[model samples]
Target chain A: MNLKIALLGGDGVGPEVLAQAVKCLQSVEVTFNHHFTFSPALVGATAIDQTGNPLPDETLEICKNSNAVLFGAIGDPKYDNDPIAKVRPEQGLLKLRKELGLFSNIRPVRVYPSLIDRSPLKKEIISGVDFTIYRELTGGIYFGEKKLNEKGTVASDLCEYSEKEISRMAHLAFKAAKNRRKKVTLIDKANVLETSRLWRKVVTRIGESYPEIELDFLFVDNAAMQMILNPAQFDVILTNNMFGDIISDEASVITGSIGLLASASVGTDFAMFEPIHGSYPQATGLDIANPIAAILSAAMLIEHHGLNEEAQAIYMAVENAIINNVVTSDLNPDSRFGTDYVGNYIANSIVDTD
Target chain B: MNLKIALLGGDGVGPEVLAQAVKCLQSVEVTFNHHFTFSPALVGATAIDQTGNPLPDETLEICKNSNAVLFGAIGDPKYDNDPIAKVRPEQGLLKLRKELGLFSNIRPVRVYPSLIDRSPLKKEIISGVDFTIYRELTGGIYFGEKKLNEKGTVASDLCEYSEKEISRMAHLAFKAAKNRRKKVTLIDKANVLETSRLWRKVVTRIGESYPEIELDFLFVDNAAMQMILNPAQFDVILTNNMFGDIISDEASVITGSIGLLASASVGTDFAMFEPIHGSYPQATGLDIANPIAAILSAAMLIEHHGLNEEAQAIYMAVENAIINNVVTSDLNPDSRFGTDYVGNYIANSIVDTD
Candidate 1:
């Protein structure tokens, strides 16, 4: 099978880590009977420097033409230090997400047994905790109508939602719940905000179509407490943009290393996958960023493109590597291995087993 | 000086915990020179059943006559399961807050030295983490215009705020900060909701008057994350209703025990003190629910009334109790003591020789 991937290696450590991912994918292709195409495009700060547009026409075109897009981290310290700047690297990524119709972000929070002790939580509290978080990416505050009043004394952003915007994601969440734990807990502040009430109304109405799945809710405040107190009770959790952004990160820390999580943003016919960690410029060229997240992202891409067995191969390889202590320095700081070595070990395990 | 205190022991464990708090205060008044007259009143589920109103006129009259109110937990499980019930227990507490103009809720999240290991977070992450949250109690979504549209498909709750609503609390928050770390982090989702913009608008303007204090703004999403990742960085956090409701609970877990926190709701002249923990109905008759929070709320009350030395005395006793393992089962399960014994122990410690 041929897989055509659009690789948007944006800026900072984006290019470095992405190269390692592509290299790992190529090795997997060579060992197994697979053909692939990787089309690299400029975006974020790099695009702005080359063409004065963060999400250039060329980059969007490549993303439009591919089966799946593999994104690297984006952002520059230069723009971060200058708070008054009109353009930012984060805008390009947000704009790309909006334009590509990537409405739902699927971030999987899983704990590796080897690193459980590293968690701040006791062994009993964090053990056996695994869940997928489906965050409504496009609709909330991120893309809401933001405006500053003329006097600069006030700035307003509108958090409005149409029923259709929530429908597509709720459907996916219900299906996921059906396969996993048969439970979907919708997180929202229905008792407080109008926007939250709209969310509860829409999701609760849509939930009726999938009666096989148990539906429950929690106010955002209570939900935040419960996430830390007991995370084992959740399975396929669904929430809006802002709540998802906060809870997913908080949930990420439940596992000892946040560097092990992978996420995918998918629309009707297109999908994009990436490791959930940020651009660590300090780790640039050092080749030690716990590449399993990136490798697992590749696994998601393959599964997303109708290669279930091949995707499992990638999943099992990484899991086996973790179980056997074949990890990068981030996961096992005492383990003297680079990102490439760990990636190669996982790739070899994938091909050698079958 | 004599002060009339209206004690509303609303439901289940409410009476149990409030009894412990009042006992401590009674001892304090005898040992010191302050005298508090306790007038009991019925509210919540009990009131709704007998008088057909949670906030009955008699209860309101008692409250009006009192100098300060000591509110135990409200809400009953009987009313909780029914979604359509209009005259509910929570309505009484909400009404009391609105009627009495108790606009600012002061919640303190402190990591106890003895139980910091109980945190889901790493030990280093939660150590020495002490911050007070100032939540605007009477405005934003709770009091916003809520409407169930003619179309059953859509429901909207309006979130609106004006200059005065935010300014008064902003100034109070700055005043509190001046007495502590001299830094206030304003938590708002200004990039999403119009009400937040209004909050930011007025608060920023009010913040200018307190130039000696440091000011920083955090989007509600970032504040939630920071509360977990690095809670110690915050000194005084000020936010609107909904954000505060969420972040405070998140901050509660970092302290590792919801039973350890207390809050005070204050208005222009009236104030209400209550433990931050909810009415644990299951533990009501078991004599196991922690009462340190309730007793601490009494401490805050005495301080609010300008009995600073007495307030410090209570703090020291509570600290000593926690340090000496003279705690309830929640904090020290094997410490060979129940709730009543621990409450008595703390009150005894208040009149210490040291």
Candidate 2:
């Protein structure tokens, strides 16, 4: 099989960590006897520095031509602090998502037994905790109409949703639930917000099509509490863009290592995989940032392409690395392994296992 | 001093637990030699059942005439499950906040040493966690204009903020911080939403007047993660309505006992106190509900009236009850104490201490 993958190592530690994922993917190519072509493009702060646009036309064209896009991280400290900055690094990523029509963001959170003690939660609370979040990425307040009055005394942002938007994500969540614990908890503010009521109505209708899936509801505020008090109660959480952003990030920390979470964003025709962690500007060029999330993202990309066995190989290698204590400082502070060392170790493990 | 207080025990365990708070207040009245008048009013689902209105005219009138209001819980599963119902128990509380101009909702979260083991988080993470959340109550998406398309295919909710709205809450949060830890963290989505930028701009300007206090900012998503990762790092959290609702609820569970948390809603001319926990319909008549939160709310009411010593008396008594293990089943599952029993114990302790 031949696969074309777009690689966007946006900024900061994104480039270093993504390099490790590429190395592991190359190892997979040799071990599995598959042909793969990698196309590199500039995006985010680095792209803005060079082309004066976060998502240059060339970058979008490269991504449009690829089978799947593997994204590292984006954002820079310089752009984050400036509220009035016209061209921001995040806008580049947001524009890419809109252009690609990526509407669903899938993030799976799981607790590894070996690292259970590292979590801030009690062992009893975090043990056996595994859940996935289905977030609507293309719509809601982030893409809604925003306005600032002439006097600048008042500002507003619209949070709008259509049945088409809600239904597409609902179908994805229900399909995923069928393969998991067969439950989907839709989190929204239905009692107060009109959009939430729409979400409940459409999702309820969609649930009828999937008779095997058990659908439930939770107010976003209550869901936030439940996430801390009892995260294991959830199987798949579906929510709007803003609530999803907050809930998924909240869910990410429960595993004790934000460095190990990977996410995939999918639309009708395009999909992008990336680590949930930010660019980590402080760790830029240090070669100390964790590469596991990026490597896992590569595995997800492979799985997206219908290569189940190859994806499982990557997962097995990652799990083996964790069990053997071949991890970066984020997981085991005493470990002396850097990003490249851990990446090389995982790549080697994959080849040796084969 | 003479005081007029409106008491609204709306639904479920609201009336039962609120009775305990009233009992503690009565004990304070007798011990402090003050005259207090209690006016009973109907609100929430119970009011809807009797009068077909959640917030009746008489109820609003009673609240307007009172100096301060002591509220119980609201909402019922019967109303909560029905999405199309025109009347909701929550609407009463939202209307009351708007009518009374209660712009700020204050919730303080602290970890009690005696109940520290009950927390889901590790002891080290929640040991000295102490912070207050100042939430803008009567603005943002909850009170914004909501629209549903004629075909019901699309829905939108506006999240608007004015300089006036942001500054008023900012002043209260800054003033509160002046008395506690001299730091205020403003959480918003300035990186994406326009209203958030306005929040940052207004709050930054307000921080200039309070030179002695430190002001910081966090994106709402990052703030959600930080709340779980290191809650102790926060001193006072100031945020808009929706984020506040989620963050405060999330912060409540870190202390292990949501039943022990209390909140206050205040305006220029009036104030209201209530427990942060909701009406537990399951435990309504069983007397198994915890009353500490209600009792603590009564303490806040006294403090609002400038009776600090009187408030301290209630706090000391409540602490004495917890220290003596005279708590409800929620606090100590093995203990057989009921709501009335714990309330009586705390009231008796308040009198005995005087």
**Chain B TM-score against the true chain B, each candidate:** 0.94, 0.93
lDDT of 2 by residue, A1-354 (tens): 799999999999998889999988998899998888999999999999999999999999999999999999999989889878899998899899989999999998999899998898999999999999999998999989999999999999999999999999999999989878999999999989999999999999999999999999999999999999899999999999999999999999998978899999999999999998899999998879999999999998998788878888888889999999999988888999999999999988885343
Worst 10 residues of 2 chain A by lDDT: A345-354
TM-score of chain A of each: 0.92, 0.93
Q: How much is the lDDT of residue A189 in candidate 1?
A: 80
For A1-354, candidate 1 gives per-residue lDDT tens digits of 898999987876677667767766786687667888999998988888888888998888999999999988888887789989788888889888878899999988877777788776667888888889999988765565555556554444445566777888899899888768889988988766776777777888889999899988988888898888888889988998878987887788777777778899999878899888887767767777667777788888887777767777888888888888888877776898787788778777776355
lDDT (Cα, tens digit) per residue for candidate 1, span B230-339: 89899999998878888888888877788888899999979999997788888888888888888999889888888777888888888988999988887876867778
The best candidate by lDDT is 2
- Candidate 2, residues B56-75, lDDT tens digits: the string is 99999999999899999999
Candidate 2, residue A153: CA error in Å? 2.0
Output DockQ, candidate 2. Answer: 0.90
Off by over 4 Å in 2: A45-56, A75-91, A351-354, B45-56, B76-92, B351-354
